[model samples]
Target: MNINRLVWIIMHVAANIKNYKFSVIYLLLMLIVSCRRSTEIGAPVVNSSNAVLPAPTKQLSIVPVKIDTLVNHPVLERGVIGEWDSTDVLNPSVIKFKDKYFNYYSGFDGKLWRTGVAVSNDGISWQKFVGNPVLAPSISDWDTGYIAGNGTAIYFAQRIYYFYQGINDRGIANIGLAVSDDGFHFKKHPNPILATGPAGAWDSDSVGDPFVIEKGEALYLYYLGQDSVGVQRLGIAKSVDGLHWTRLSNNPVLDIGAGGSFDENGLGEPSIAYQPPYFYMFYTGRASDEIRNIGYAISTDGIHWKKISTTGLISNKLRSEWFSKVICDTTLIAVGGGKWAVWFGGGNLPVPAENLNGQIGMLILDLGQQRDMTSFDANSDWSRSLVKSTDVLLGSFEIEGDLGKRSTWLGPKAHLTLATTDHAGNSMAGKPIIVEGWAPAQFISSKTGQYEPLTISISINGKIAAKRTFVSDDMFRIEILWPEIAQLLDHTGFVEMDMSADRAIVPAQFGVSKDSRNLSFKVTRIYFH
Candidate 1:
């Protein structure tokens, strides 16, 4: 039989089989047999059932490399020195002046908290100012009790302006301003720049954690406000001269998370940084679990905000030493090489004594790395939409499983569409994109007739670029890669997905309490790399 005729028959059978992997294998074998018989006079007849196929060649595996974000250097640990910072030190704010790195932190003697200064050439090793407690509490002033040792500092108008939180005799926290000429000694202003809001306001109880950034001709101060109900939120105020401030009409710009959320309890200790088109806010989120971890949010304008993750970015799970109790009072500074460093106060244990006895830890965040673009987790900021058809409903779903509660549902016949521009911005084009995730096969089988394979198709610019059909009787992991598309660079496009049963099917559970049309499969994670 002619080799061409034999190859055509094999391809026809493979197409009817509906298995992508087997079809590719058959094609390769046909090529091998044809190349070997090129010099022969007549085409060799090949047996379909007994023909020997060469062993498949292994493809080179490529491992992705990620830049290290968090690099820890405990430059301000307690008990390392017995000077003015002998007892405890927390709340670190860093500023660069001329050639040295100025580290201003809060220190506690046996009695009260006071502000102190330490200078370093490289930001690691530090030497306390000869006259420590550069700005101590005044005997007869509003900030007599305590002055925040670790607060925000900036150089403007040929002077250093330190913005700190002061607790008065009534224990009410308020914002204060101090001016430093030489970056060492600071002179406090007469009155509190920003006092607590009116009784019944969101920030009625107290205000603290001042994070200031200069934009345009005005300086914006973002702080933590505790209400009479004890719910802490974020509020903003603006000042032109660095002393007097006017609170925005939309006070409490960021409120507590939804019920049963990571920051559901309250929010506190905000740190803000401006990186051109976006301003990043890092703060401490208090969850109902009694866990306080670092959370992140981003904003195009200083007022409106969007959280980066549903859960805390830096949690006890990330660092075992910090235990899951406390990680707050963050100060972010750009370290220049497409990286940012965060200095925050963390406690070793969850107890109160340990909380008060905190130390500063540093972590770096790589801005060049790819981040998650989907939010199946209830806590993320990604918006999920549910699409309904006659037989099935699809999108992010909530299902009860052996694990208390899970949000892994990707409804049968579901369509998931995400904006690539939001995650990649202008740098998306020409970058290698990988879509990888897993789903529970048993659940999917139960819903779409019985153990039928599901087909997933990815479309770029409304054109189907890649498709895969996989059986899901067990845990199914799927990864599809698309090479760089030059046209996608800097342009906005939708990465659309269609996940449906291979054949016409009905919901697995007909009389279930939940809507059958709403039943979905568990989608572990769907992200681009």
Candidate 2:
């Protein structure tokens, strides 16, 4: 086969793997993929013979939510007597040790920042180590000052490694590694595993918040590198033993390039979770707070990344919430039984004086919420649609959950997505496509701030047709614009639509009704036309 055919075949095989089960077969296939060594045309040999394929792509969590959400946002440890966990809770790293959970954190102790430990039965509630401050500043000949900052945490077989930022008295930030046999107690390394970046590199100034992940025998470290300009970017290095590292001469594994992009300002605090065929990373930056913001990017190999999207993750949420100011450190844990917990450290308040004494509070992850996101993606695979610049789309999801469980998508804004595909499922960029929905319902669509009898031309495939320039006051009609949508139309595809054009009344109170209880809300009824 020609090289191009081989490449296309590989891509085709990759896209379909998302449909199978995960097992040793999958791991062997993944190993073969990892061994490819190069993404180039002549990439190394891949064993296609009887290799167990990767699990099928069930769904993508384009949107995430808080589930099993903790009412008391910033969990306080009983061992400590302070509020807001003392104000910092800067870098929160959590791991599941058998059945219990452990949280390793880095906060200030009045004078300087250091690391500590806390225990938890359920992730929501935590207890600080009576003998707190599991990992502190460095005083060895190698580490001169303190554990400047932290990155996401990970658990490996018998050892727990918390990658942290070590800043010397000279204020030079470098990456350091600490390990623990048990989650509560830790031992710091006498030598910094990875130091500052080369003089003319994107991380010329310093490297901080190292996130160490072990992939096979090689341990890949993802961390933040700062240049003299103070612009923070992400870099990657690999090791076989989690010590003695060799920098990817072509460092700056990730960076903000060109215009005022969502990730333009910078991408720092690299966190990695070995999820299937790829290693996923969540980085924070200036675009993190944009109303349409949520910082993210993906990678197959720890070195080369795939930008699923440039737009930020978890955007335009809680602008007023206590921790609304930022969305940093996206942490996820597959705590068995298919539950994923993602905790973030982003609040508006400054580090309190009390917190300066060593305590900090940040947002917690609701694994149930994450599971819902997975279900949402599984339930409603996302596809894009296009409308005139002045059009809006109204849509809602009917989710069934046990008491105290709920799911939430990131935003309601109808994204004007234009991709390079035509109605025939082939690349057709810069070509016009209709923007109509099979709105089988008579109720109005949420045509907020858009054309009423909206008629517009748009290019790109306009993936799944879920949104349209329509709305209704009466909640009677059911909408089923799925991801694998049918083509846009002009005829009476949508039922109960305003056929008369303007002289029609649409209901607003549509969708499933709810019954509110003392503790939670439940969906009692689902209405469909």
Candidate 3:
């Protein structure tokens, strides 16, 4: 297929979803309401029984943005980072390590395209790697056609393994593999491991954008699956060794709705991060029928998810005039502790700015502090003792090791409660319990500053469970009660306070619960007499 035809194919496939994820055979009986039938390259993809492709959405339209506004919002303030080279910096996925930052992006020069890798020490200043086009098209492999636009969901293990999309000679986009010892250099798979859906399926038209991650022994693949209608569906799969895979019930993890809403037209390019028990997925979606915006979703298990669409995370509110569609290739990096940042390729697709500098942009998300990410087992040495500041401590409190530690805090029923006093026996309100991964911390300033959600989770035996999440008038005292924890407690669990987030929180009355969202922060101290 020619480059222009390929581009149109993607544009067509995303807008029409009625038959997107079903089999071709099913399409034979249930035809699309509207298909923008054309022969840019040749005949369209036949449905099962060799029927014609589904009709495109009649109301489909592209509202291109002005080059200026979109580029300024992201981190590419220094320069367009080689964006002027025609290698559309789409599908921007970046990872940060101890010394340098690595960026993996799609090089879509209007036609033939594939994935590339770049590096930087400071998140802003970048240096493209020698192995620039790290994983380009190789017709000799299963990805026979010219390769282009792709997405990868990743996990940090002994090495980085990525599952991305590659098109074949027939214009079919399929998922393939690549592995890297360091973040920069990569080696592609000898074959296309995952391919287009069977003749009659939601993903039958073509498959693109594979988001990969690992949960313990099982490796999960989250990707965009499309049907002839062009509508996009979020699909998923599981693997044992990260190489071979087992297709789940051919079910979509998520899909876009139709007409006039956030994510109404379609959803594209999924970026995900495991903030402990909860997995947060961020992707691009159309809003108000014309504009594209960022949508958010959270999941405890990668399979089941809850989407929050009432309000989008990013908006044209600040730079409305310069930003048209205003979205693409969202790449988020959590710089250890509790700081978070997101970057993406932005600019007017057909329109160029003054310097033609309309390029990459970043969304700075500073997640105050991080919480403890450890799962506790209350069996080894379960000891609970609170230190009632023998001396009024400021900034730091001191409790010695000889303060009587116990291996068993009264069987399976172990409870850890804490209440703080400031030299005088009184309640203290409005203390900060710093946290992570979440944005717009729940704080109320009208009443001496209040913290809304004080959720914490604990592990019992081998199972993880929630411990506490309640309100406290004495925010300083941080009233914590765990009678149930005291009753079924063991000695394996340890007492620690939250530290990832940098808020001035009272750790004395802190506790844990079975909420997955508690992954980004940690506990440091407990206050008890």
The candidates, ranked best first by TM-score, are 1, 3, 2
Candidate 3 structure quality by residue, lDDT tens digits, 153-245 = 354556777667665555556677788887766777676566666666887766666666554445666767777666667867666666655
List candidate 3 stretches off by more than 4 Å: 1-87, 153-157, 182-184, 287-290, 320-323, 336-338, 350-358, 366-529
Residue-level lDDT for 146 in candidate 2: 37
Summed over model 3, clashes come to 83
* Candidate closest to the true structure, highest TM-score: 1
Q: What local lDDT does model 2 show for residue 502? A: 24
Which of 2 and 3 is ahead in TM-score?
Answer: 3
Ranking by lDDT: 1, 3, 2
Tens-digit per-residue lDDT, 1-529, candidate 2: 2322322433343344300123432222111110000000122211112211111121232322233322224444212334323435556777777566677766553345556677766555577777766666666544465343464456764677766666555556666667788776777676667766556666565666666765434566676766655566676676656666666655665766446676664556556654322345666554433211235564433565655546555544433364554445555564322224555555553221113122233332322211111111212322231111111111222333443343221111212222222222343322333322222122222322332442111111222333333333221222434222234421212111111122222223233234221111111221111
Between candidates 1 and 2, the one scoring higher on lDDT is: 1
The superposed Cα distance between candidate 1 and the true structure at residue 68, in angstroms, equals: 3.0
TM-scores for every candidate against the unseen true structure: 0.56, 0.52, 0.55
